[model samples]
Structure formats: C-alpha cells, structure tokens
Target: MSHHRSPPSPPPPEPPESPSSVYCTPSPQSKATTPSPTARFFLSRHQSFIKPSPLTKHILPRQQSSNTLPPEFPYEHDTAKTSVGLYLRKHRRTNPAIWCSAIICLIFSILFIFIVVAILIIFLVVKPKTPVLDTSHATLNVIYFDSPGYFNGDFTFIANFSNPNKKLNVRFEHAVMQLYFEDGLIATQSIQPFSQRRKETGVVVIRFVSSLVSMSSNHARELQKQVMSNKVFYSVRGTFKVRASLGAIHFSYWLHGQCELQMSSPPSGSLMARTCKTKR
Candidate 1:
C-alpha cells in the first residue's frame, strides 16, 4: 500500500451558483464568488426581495397626510422599517352634507314654530274692531245756477272719525270725500292721512266748492224742486284705507262711509238732519 500511495483528484466542480444564493452572501473583491454578467443581472433584479430581519412584524404603508389620522392617535413603532406616524387606516365614514342639511332643517322648523306661536298670541291678546264715521256739523253757504244743468255751490262740513276698540288704535290712509246730489257726483275733496288713539275721536274740516259743474236733467230738476220747498237733499261718500293695530299686531281693510244730509236752502242754510253709516 505504501509503494502504491497516490493523491485523490479534487471533488467535481460544484453546480453553478444561483443568483439568490450569491446575492445573500455578498462579499467585496472575491474572485471565486464574483458573479458573471448573467448572474449579476439576475442578482440586481432580485436584490429587493432579500431584506435584513430587523423586526418580525410587517410595517404599514406611509399615509399621505397627517390629518388622515384618527382624532385620538397614539404613535407606535414595532419594526425598525416602520415610522411612529404610520398606522392602520380607520375609515370614520361620515357624511358632512347630510349633517349640514339636518342642522338647517332643524333651525327652520324652530323659527316656523316660534312665528306661529307669536301670531296666535297676538290674535288672542288684541281683538280688532271697526272704526266709526260721523258728521258733527254741515252748512250750505251759497247755491247759484249758470244754467239748468250747470250749477255752482259752496258746502262745508266737519267729519268725525272715532275709534271704538278700547285696545286697538286706528289709522286712515288715502282718505277721499265725494259729494253727490240725487245719486250724481257733484264734487270731490282730498283729506290727509290721520291717526286716532284707542277710543279717541279725530275731526277734519272739509269744504267743497262746485265750479261750473254740470248736472244731469234728473239731478237738476230734483235740486230745483228741493230749493223751491226750502229743503235740499245731498249725499256724501268717504273712502279710506283703514289700519287697526294693537301693539305689534296689525290688520288692514277698506272702509266705505255713506251719509245723507237734509239742509235748508241758501244763505244761512244749515244741516237739518243727517243719517250716516260705515261699512267694511
């Protein structure tokens, strides 16, 4: 055996190294382990898969915004690769549009209820009543005829307006006065807007002077006949926009006043009698 001693051949060449094994055990300036061009390409492509085991737990993805975090967020870091700010996303799932709409609806409902209650209280506390119109005095100063159908006259009157409601005040707007003879319009006059306290009376002096007013045949004949008998008949109409108010409650309506007057003929002519009525 000593005379036949011979060294054994080296072991057969190892199988080609794989990229995965070569990249994991990287060493600088080592000829035997140096990767070939093909192996280098494979190593470069697979380099991202091989990572150091700094910690075992998986790291969450980084959030784009900090405000996307929870209202009560506690920072935690379980791995060296993960940051304290990165946390699992919790979708709060809220509807801001629906919440805003609900708030607006609630406010409107409260306002409507309050307004209804206030209006009801006003109606109960202040019951509105109609005002009255009456005449205190009237006189016919002159009457002259330019023709059978054309006439001139001067009339004067004091109009009395009274508020009957003890709790409601009254105001008259756009007041106008018209004089008629035998259902025919003779003259018109204007009166200023006026106000009256509760249960108070207001007076306005009105004067009408007919200047060359033409009358119908029936009206002229009736006027002539009345003048002959020393008893003249005339009518007056009043139109007003009346507002009745108590505190903050206010109601408005149109009022019509009609009066019939009997007067003695010419020059010291005075009102003998009058009948008046007011309607709403």
Candidate 2:
C-alpha cells in the first residue's frame, strides 16, 4: 500500500541560548584568518610583562655556561673576576708611595757609603806628617840673690816650630813651658796661638822671671860649687797643642818636649855659652 508517510516533523527549533552556555562557548570565527594589528600589539605587550622563573644552579648545563663565556677570558667565574679586579685596584692605589720611599732610602745609603770610601782613599794617599819642634839655648837676662838661699833670674828663650809636610798647614794653639832646678819649679811661660804655612818655620820668643825662689841647703851648696867650677845645669819641659790639616782632613797632636841646658859661664852680651838637649 502506498501509504503517504507524514513528513517527518521538522526538527525542534533550537532553544534560546542560556546564560551559562553563552559564557562557556567559544565565539564564532571570522572569515578573515590573519590576526589584526591591535591583537598582535597586545600579545607582544603581554609577553614582555611576564617574568621568567629562576634557573637552578645545580641543574645548569655545563655546555650552556661554557658557550656564554669567551675562551680567552682569564677568570673562571664571576666571583674570581671580581676578586682579581679588587686586588689590582688596591695595589694600584698603594704601591707607588711605598716604592718611592724605598728608592729614596736606597739612594741615600749609597751616597753615604761612597763618601766614606772617598775619604778613606784620600787619607791613605796623603800620608800627612806632624810638625817638628826645635828649641834654642836660653840666656840669662838678669841674675841676683836677695838672700843666701834666695835666687832669682830673668831668662829669655827661643822656640822654632817647623812644618815638615809640603802640602799640609799646621796650627799651634798654645805652648806651656816650665823651668825646673833640681825638680823644683823655677818659672813658667805661655805662648799665643799661631799658624804655619806648608814647609814654613815659626819663631816664638818667651821671657820668664823667677822671683824669691828659695833653694835647699844642699842645693845652695851644690850651686856654689858649680859656680866655682863654672858649670851650671837647668831643665825645661814644654807641651804644645798642634793641629795638622791637609785640605779638608785635619788631625790634632800633643807635642811634648824635654830639654836640659848646661852653661859653662855666666851669660853676657848678645850670646850665651850653653848647650841644649831636646826630645819630641
């Protein structure tokens, strides 16, 4: 039988969209596939604002670290690089001042040593000599006896100081002269300071008077016997402070001398018959 099937009822019309479905479902795509300029700018901004998570040091790959550093770099790591930089900076600040002071001290020491060596060499080569001293005979200017045992006399003497060094100068500060008769002080004389040129001679004249000098009884008797026999004896002691100089170098010396005099007759006129013995 050709039964006319009623047309399948049209599918039920879709229900109006619910509020929950509208929020959960995706929007329909536009026919244009490429994103717009505004959308691209917004995506780039979002990516830039997002922060990356930290990398764990223990899990870092060795190859990645090696690739990041240049092969010719001296330090192995950041910490080592920082330490070397700090050491270099500190040394640069302090080393110059220290080195300057050390160099100055070394130079001064060398100069002082050189000066001392030069002085020693000059002294060895020079070989300077001390001055020479000579004494002439003394003459009696006046002689008198106030009492039997009291004897007095005025005597004149000459001293010759000669510098033997050809290139050295000599200075005599002072001279102390003492006259003795049988170990008793009879007179004393002092001379002023003077300077002598190289290989030059200086003359000093001294006059001393003995006043109220008493002799021992034995001495008086001996003196009387000597007077009758025309023989008399006297002693003189002298000390001189002298300085010898050769250029800048100078040295001091004490010149000591002892002399004995013998007179065979009383001194008269301009000359005296006397003999003198002297020692340096």
Please name the candidate that would achieve the greatest lDDT relative to the true structure: 1
Clash counts for all predictions = 0, 0
Q: How do all models score by TM-score?
A: 0.59, 0.52
lDDT of 2 at 254: 82
User: What does candidate 1's lDDT look like per residue over 1-280, in tens digits?
Assistant: 3687589989999778887656454457676777799999998879878774645223433353333544345343234225433554435766999999999999999999988987687667666667888996999988888977898999998899999888888889779999998888888999999999998998899999998899888878888889889999989999999987777767689999999999999888899999999999
Please, what is the whole-model Cα lDDT of each candidate in the order they appear? 0.84, 0.73
**For residues 1-280, could you state the per-residue lDDT of candidate 2 as single tens digits?**
6988887889889868787656444345653565789988998999999865566555776766664455566466666778779988884356887989999999999999987986686568766666766566567555567888887877777767788777778888877988777787779998888999898987888787888888777777776676566666767778888887777877677887666666554555123344443334
- How does residue 81 of candidate 2 score in lDDT? 74
Collision pairs in model 1: none
Residue 93 shift from truth in candidate 1, angstroms: 15
The TM-score leader among the candidates is 1
